[model samples]
Target: MYVLGLGGSNHGFSACLLKDGHLESMIADERITRKKYGVGLGMRLAQGFSRNYCLDMEGICLEEVDKIVGNDLLVPTMYFRLQDKIQLINHHLAHAYSAYYPSGMDECAIIVMDGVGSKRKAGEEYEYESMTLYYAKNGKFDVIKKQYGYNLPGTDYVENSLGIFYAMITDIIGFGEHEEGKTMGLAPYGDKEFYEKIRKYIRYDNHANIEFNSSDIQEMLQLKEDVQAIKNQEEKERICQKIAWAGQQILEEIYVDIARYLQEETQCKNLCIAGGVALNSVANYKIHKKGFYDNIFITPASGDDGTAIGAAYYGYYH
Candidate 1:
């Protein structure tokens, strides 16, 4: 059977074709459009992607494809082009499937974390979660837990997002939006004392779910304001680097703690991690070194762009 998968969100937009359980062709919209992060996909781009990649995969006809799958968050938008062919896959389930299947493990614990997933109507503080955990065994999947971050209605900022916190720090350091890697690289040069101050702001529940208080957000903004007013370039760089270090420290600690919790709960030695945050090598390495899992697998395409792979796997198996 030939299956076509599609994914689209604020971070990346992509598509993939799978034939009889093997990848036939996969293409991210950013590669074709030359736009970084590949944020949006209108009907035109969706149709073009399908016609060029999905329909032509190894001479497979679009009509011959058995199923068309889409990320749960993107399927409604995709309905115009795919019509009845499209089926929805949950956001976190897609991420877990993407990581677990690609890891080549028969069983594993999966963690998916990103900025946001699903849509929110007004007055819904937790319309979507920022992170989730799942256990997969022999092609079966079960949700262990999912954590939410809160945001007020009509506000651009989420009060409890590590992704947003990192992105805000990236901007505070004068890096353009989506340039989180620059901050990660600069983190090692930062002062240890500053990192301590930043790490204290993060608190979590017994399930390893994270939340940030209003005071923490205000303090972060104040720090940004302070850094912005610095007169010396060296001083600014020093402070920004410190902030980056602190951010990385918080991220790493939270990831390790969550992984530890999962290991304790599941007793599974194999772990699969996905989402944009999984791209942070520092945290990934720390999680590996913590000895919670005998083997750690992170998908090559850990970001939102790779959700197409997960959507396809969901369609094929589920």
Candidate 2:
């Protein structure tokens, strides 16, 4: 069977064609359209797919595949309709499964953390929160195994996301999106004091499921119109470093704790991780050093785009 995976955020989309469990061809909508995220390029591409291909390897027609998977051709929208032949995988779950399946590990604890996933209702919090845990064992996926999520009450979940937190600090430091890596690089130069202060904003239970208080740093800072008046360029750099460090620190602590907890609970030595946060190389390095698991695997395309692949895999395998 041929399995296809697609992933990305608002700025772009990526698609991977997998046949017999190996990646065959992968393309991004942005590349084809020359648009950063391929915002409106999907329909054009779907039209192209229809004209170009015949007898899609999966016993489905190109028109049918396009109809079902091409509905949400725009970036960041998950409304794609791929003729219902391809199973839809939850964006994050795809990240989780992608990591696990490729790792060749039988039993393992998986953690997928990202800015957001297709939104799920959480009581008064209509917006989605991060899902930090998903465990795979005996060839099945379980989301309830032990998970950590965070959302600020009465606010859009993205508003308080760690991904957004990092992105904002990156911009505040004058780096913009391209400079996010610079912020990450500067993190080692800072102290942990900022992390201590930010910790007050995060609330989580014994399981490490998180919730941010309304008075979190982002909200508190927004209250002051001229936040820059007090925080100059140097201060902003410090803040950026602090934000990077804190985000890294929290993820490491939580992931390690969760790994240990899951390891103990499931007695599994293999671990896999996906999602945007899994892209945190610093945390990945730390997790590697902590030696919580005999092996760890993280998806290379650890974002929403991978959901397309996950959806395909889930459809074919499950």
The prediction achieving the highest lDDT against the true structure is 1
Model 2, which residues run further than 4 Å from truth? 9-12, 33-87, 122-127, 145-156, 159-180, 217-227, 230-235
Please list all clashing residue pairs in model 1, or write none if there are none. Answer: none
- Which candidate number has the best TM-score? 1
Instruction: Return model 1's CA RMSD, one decimal.
Output: 2.4
Residues 163-228 of candidate 1: C-alpha lDDT, one tens digit per residue? 767777787788887788898999998867686677767776657778875567677777778888
Instruction: Quantify all predictions' global Cα lDDT against the true fold.
Output: 0.78, 0.57
Q: On residues 192-297, what C-alpha lDDT tens digit does candidate 2 reach at each position? A: 8667755665555555455544456455346223435555676755665666676556656765665566666666778888777666787778878888788888
Model 2 poorest 10 in a row by lDDT: 65-74
TM-score per model over all chains: 0.90, 0.76
Candidate 1 accuracy as lDDT = 0.78
- lDDT at 21, model 2: 60
